[model samples]
Target: MRHTLTLFVTLTVFWLLNSGHNTVLMTLLGLVSIIFVLYVAHKMDVVDHESQPVHLSLKFPGYFLWLLKELVLANISVVKSIWLGNSTISPCLMTIKSSQKTDLGIVIYANSITITPGTVSVDLIGDRITVHSLFKENIEFLKAGEMDRRVTELES
Candidate 1:
């Protein structure tokens, strides 16, 4: 029930912010659309913990800020490697251990690795993620476990 309400409120707010119209007709239409979406989502059975993720709501903002910073740093590193040419780049594939206990946390960690400019998560089997990286340092960074730790924290 809580997840359903959260989804509805989030959808309504998202609609209002994107639409940028407050007229009665527009509001009514938005409500109708949101209700339809909520109904469909409920019927699809995706409104539960993994999909809605209300449990992670409070911690996600901080994690997002950290991820944004990491993305910028990664972009810089990739650009620097490009400028330095092929000789400076070291391509490697490696497997990293993830400490996340939940599916959502594991997915988040793998997706995070993929999104960071220099790395791609190629596979996930159980607690291990196979990642490919343009630079050996990127793999070293993953081996250091900061991102994995943060994602594990998200699960808690």
Candidate 2:
């Protein structure tokens, strides 16, 4: 029931912000669309915790800020490597272990790896993830487990 309410409010806000139409007709249309979406989602049984993820809301901002910082640092590292030529690149394919207890947490860890400029998550199975990185240091960074720890904390 709470999830449904949250979804409804989220959809309404999203529609209002994106549509940017204040007229009655537009408002009615948006409401209709939101209702249709809610009905379909209820039927599909996807409007649960995984879909809404309200549990992660409190920790998400901190994780996002960390991710943003990592993104900038990775961009700089990649650019520096490019300027220094291929000789400075040490590409590696390695498998790393993840400690996250949920599918969402594992996915967040894998996606975080893929999002950072120098690394790509190639595969994820159970608690293990295989990654390909432009720089060996990127793989080492994953091995260090700070991002994995943070994502685990987010899920907790």
Candidate 3:
């Protein structure tokens, strides 16, 4: 029931933000659309009730701050590497163990790794993630397991 409500509210907000109109008719249409889509989704069984993990709403702010800091640091590292005279690029492929108990948590971890500049998650097999690193330094960062730890903390 909570997931259904969340889906409805999210779709309505997205429709309103993208529609760029403030008419009652359009608002009513958006609400109807949300309800219809969610109903169809529920019938299709695409949204598994068990897969949606309950999260601490208060932890999101801290997680966002941490992700922002990592993004900044990664940007700086990439820029420094570009400026460095030597071509220190050492491509490495490695498998990292994912500690996330839920599929959503694993998806978050993989997406976060891909979002960072130097690393890309090529494949996810069970609890193992295959990552390709642009440089040797990036490989070290992945091996440190900080990303997995942070994402798990957020998904809690």
- Specify the poorest-scoring 10-residue window by lDDT in model 1: 48-57
Candidate 1 lDDT over residue span 65-124, tens digit each = 999999999999899989989999999999999999889999999999999999999999
Residue 154, candidate 1: Cα error in Å is 2.0
Candidate 2 local lDDT, 1-156, one digit each (tens):
889999999999999899988999999999999999999999999998888889999999999999999999999999999999999999999999999998888988899999999999999888999999999889988899999999999999
lDDT of 1: 0.94
Better of 2 and 3 by lDDT: 2
Which parts of model 3 have CA positions greater than 4 angstroms off?
A: 48-56, 83-86
Error of 3 at 67 (Å): 1.3
Q: In terms of TM-score, which candidate is strongest?
A: 2
Report model 1's TM-score to 2 decimal places: 0.93
For TM-score, candidate 1 versus 2, the one ahead is 2
- On the 0 to 100 scale, the lDDT of residue 87 in model 1 is 94
Candidate 2: stretches off by over 4 Å: none
TM-scores, one per candidate: 0.93, 0.96, 0.84
